[model samples]
Target: MAVIRVIYKEYIPSENLNSIVDTIWIATNYGKEIESRILPDGYVDIVFDLDKQKHLNSGNEIRISGMMTKFKKVISRKNSETLGIRFKTGQFNAISNIPLSKIKNTTINASDLFFKLNNSFLDELVEKKHHWEKVQIINKFLLAEINWSDLTPNKLEHSVCQSIQLNYRELDLNKIAKNHYISLRQLERRFKATIGVTMKEYHSIIRFNKVKDCIAKNPNLSLLNTAFDNGYFDHAHLSKEIKKMSGVNPSEL
Candidate 1:
């Protein structure tokens, strides 16, 4: 078998688009085919498979990848290039009002969701030969596609998401709902509609990311200590959750 190498890089969007877009990324696969595991990060992505011959049956190069609940595997075909636009959590609604719940844990053609991102625009994006060229085109396209005047996130849901970030280690759903003057059920319903995941699921993602960061930064930290410090019941609980979310144990992570 020939050696396989993949080049992956991420570019920050222009300052004006920072609120809605997380980063624009690209990947190029060379030689042999490779399989990559995508871990859930609670964000949505618009992917463009630049390989014309392997484009979807509909002949559209663009596809929408929804929020992932668990790890999923993707094949990077040899000698293929792909570009991805990752949207910030809860910010995807600015471009298209489609409810995230409709596409959660699934991948769908871009045309199925919104008509604004038409074929010509996608073709222009795909035709770019260099990474920087593609980035510039996408930045300009998103600026035209998103309407700032009418973009408004639900205040309650936004606050809840912010609170989750601030209190990631110890998320109290009941208290959060009470503070926001809504019932737990109502808060969860609104969060699912807006964020495409339950509050608890999002919280788990936040906590897992924190633990992963802590372990990465403090390599000497013991799993038992990390778990307690991050509010996990114990080492066993931490390992189970990590394995479930990332398909790896804490040590492997």
Candidate 2:
């Protein structure tokens, strides 16, 4: 099978930088073991598992569509390949326009929705459309299906997370707080409580995930070059963050 085209971007809320979400789009090919730990903010992932396995915590074997809103940690050891569309934050609602909290700890069959929306898109990709066009189509589909109502605006943190997804690269948390007329400390507290990780840790993970995508696409690429290109200060700093979260160095991977 051809390598899948995976598009990933890190977003910082223009108004609230501390509370941002990362959006990832995977097309065509199945994914590899994505070792991710739970952050302060929860996420809802939509995946299609081709190989059947029992639940990690609950030893039950079943094929189902599901949403995980709260998790301590997520580690995929083996046989965990799938087509994953994930939203990592309580600020973002389910891809099916549903509230994540409402569906937490439950599994629903999302095959219909998954196939309905993604099938045609993949077919078009097979037809050899430009990469930009593929991205545009995916964005259009996401915009149409995303239910904004599922998100309740309780605090500035929500605004920040939304802004990050809207503006992928250019994010400044302090500026976002000033814009919202709040102190930096206030923003930090909200982010930690709601998102589960400090602002720095969250941003580091976001940046690292972007680098991971690049490495996955071109395994032959140099790690030093990848770090520099993805906004890390240097290769050592990049290695530190990668090992911290992934338990493996970039070179080891």
Q: Tell me the RMSD of model 2 versus the true structure.
A: 10.3
lDDT of 2 by residue, 1-253 (tens): 4333323333222232123224533333234444454432235544433223423233222222233222335555343333344554644433443443344445555544454443344445334445444445445555555565674544566676665544434457777778788898998777665554555555655666677778889888777888777777788977887776566778654
Residue-level lDDT of model 1, residues 1-253, one tens digit each, is 5888888999999888998899999998877778888988879999888765575455657889888877888888778888999998988898888888888888888977667566776678777888899999889888988888998867788789889988987889999999999999988888998898899889988888889899999989888999999999999999999999899888887
Q: What is the TM-score of each candidate against the true structure?
A: 0.90, 0.45
Q: How many residue-pair clashes does candidate 1 contain?
A: 0
Superposition error at 51 for model 1 (Å): 2.3
Model 2's number of clashes is 8
lDDT for model 2 comes to 0.51
- Between which residue pairs do clashes occur in model 2? 11-164, 12-164, 13-164, 40-195, 40-196, 40-197, 41-195, 41-196
Query: For each candidate, C-alpha RMSD in Å?
Result: 2.1, 10.3
